[model samples]
Target: MAQFKPGERVEVSSNDRGFRGSWYAGTVVRREAKNTNRYVVEYDQLYEDGSGEKLLQETLDWIQLRPPPPPPEKKKVQFKFGDEVEAFYSDGWWEGAITGEHSGGKFAVFLQRL
Candidate 1:
């Protein structure tokens, strides 16, 4: 069984009839009092209503839980000024050109909306 500490974030595997193979984000609240292999987890987004007003908490076995994957590493792509690129705007990706370069692999992109 995997060991998880309290307050640690983890993903809980679904054991529901139709939701098998799904994993939900949650935090480990504590281990079960009588069962060392079980833990009490507070889900991040699992709710009891359609409005998501009530959060769901449950005791899950350690076998049904796993640590969340590590964050993705940032990659730097060199681009020259005036190089054409696609920038993600408020809601969607838009075509743009690199106007300037900044520290930490950041770039100033100018998107001209038609």
Candidate 2:
């Protein structure tokens, strides 16, 4: 029997030597015990927003699979100088471009209005 079971989340190790250290998180859609290292996996598209997509489905070696890393802690967005963004203030949301970075994650922006 395969170590990984159906519906398990796993990380696929890169097969290319040039990207030897890269890994991608995916869900085990199906698992096969007919031979060693066999499973079907579904993952999120590169541009999709957190939605899972089945991009690959083939029996692969078990050595290419591993547990995925913990989900990253939610972090505040940090805007850099010259980045176009919206800023909230006492009035409301304002369209602007970041002028400078402050000590905190705050940024100074030149508002289009006011």
Q: Which candidate number would show the highest lDDT if scored against the true structure?
A: 1
Per residue, candidate 1 scores C-alpha lDDT tens digits across 1-114 of 689999999988766664554567789999988999999998887786779788789999999888876774697567999999866554234557999999988899987655
How do the residues 1-114 of candidate 2 rate in per-residue lDDT, one tens digit apiece? 248888898877556644444456677878765864677776533323335443655456778787765665698665678998756543233457899888857778876542
- Each prediction's TM-score against the native? 0.61, 0.48
lDDT of each: 0.79, 0.64
Model 2 misplaced regions, further than 4 Å: 46-54, 72-114
Worst 10 residues of 2 by lDDT: 45-54
Q: Show how many residue pairs clash in every candidate, following the order shown.
A: 0, 0
C-alpha RMSD for every candidate: 10.9, 12.8
Give, for candidate 1, the lowest lDDT window spanning 10 residues. 86-95
